[model samples]
Target: MAEFEAERRMPAEAEQVFAIVGDLDRLSEWMPTPIGVRQTGDGEVHADVDSRDVHADGLVGVRPEQLRLEWGSEDSPDYAGWLQVEHAEPGHSSVVMHLSFLGDQPEARRHGSAAGEVRQWLDDALAQLERVVAGTS
Candidate 1:
């Protein structure tokens, strides 16, 4: 299993952050990835690559009180993670994204490997997300 976590301070309320990440469909917007997303009832969303990447369909677990998005995928059989937002203070929030992918496909190995690209992608995504959310408010 490979796990990665990145944290940042966002200039927005935890609620705003939660709402943004909750819309799993906008994933590709902030994260430089080509994700095709479709709503799968409730708040869950099925995301894929080229529509053929069907294994990673799942939901963004949103905990309003905790200000987080515990994300997981149905792909590759064993993948789970989360994005957390903490109320750092009255007008600021701390964000943390933790992801774990279980496999041994070199490209899916530990960080600094092929999987590093995805890790970095998420890092950039979170940064962009912070900017986007701050902009709206």
Candidate 2:
């Protein structure tokens, strides 16, 4: 399996970041490319590539100090990962996103490049989120 992980410190509270990531509809706002995601069930989400629907399974784990999401898409050979938030203080938190994909196909390799691009996108999005939440933007 190929893996990619990134972490960032956010000024917002953990709950705030957790809420943003948990809301499937908000993915297009932070993801590198515009993605259409809809809740398929209580904890499952379906993503659309442009307009073609892609299936994915998700699980949410909530704790007193953290929130985590484990997800995997059907199109990927073995793509699976988790996004997590750990509260460090009342107004500060850490966000970690981990993604893994398995395969060696040309298309799979191309899609793998998304790991880096997506990480940068999340960094930008988190910055914007911090500004918006702080009402400085």
The per-model lDDT (C-alpha) reads 0.70, 0.62
TM-scores for the candidates: 0.78, 0.66
lDDT of 2 by residue, 57-105 (tens): 4443334244877777655546677778888877888878776657653
Instruction: Please give the RMSD to the true structure for each candidate, in Å.
Output: 2.8, 4.1
Worst 10 residues of 1 by lDDT: 48-57
Using lDDT as the measure, the top candidate is 1
Candidate 2 C-alpha error for residue 5, in Å: 1.0
- Evaluated at residue 132, the lDDT of candidate 1 is 83
Top candidate on TM-score is 1
lDDT of 1 by residue, 1-137 (tens): 67777888888777777777767666655664555556676767777654224445686666777766676765555677788877778777888888777766443567564577667766887788888888877
Worst 10 residues of 2 by lDDT: 105-114
Candidate 1 TM-score, true structure as reference: 0.78
Alpha carbon RMSD to native, model 2: 4.1
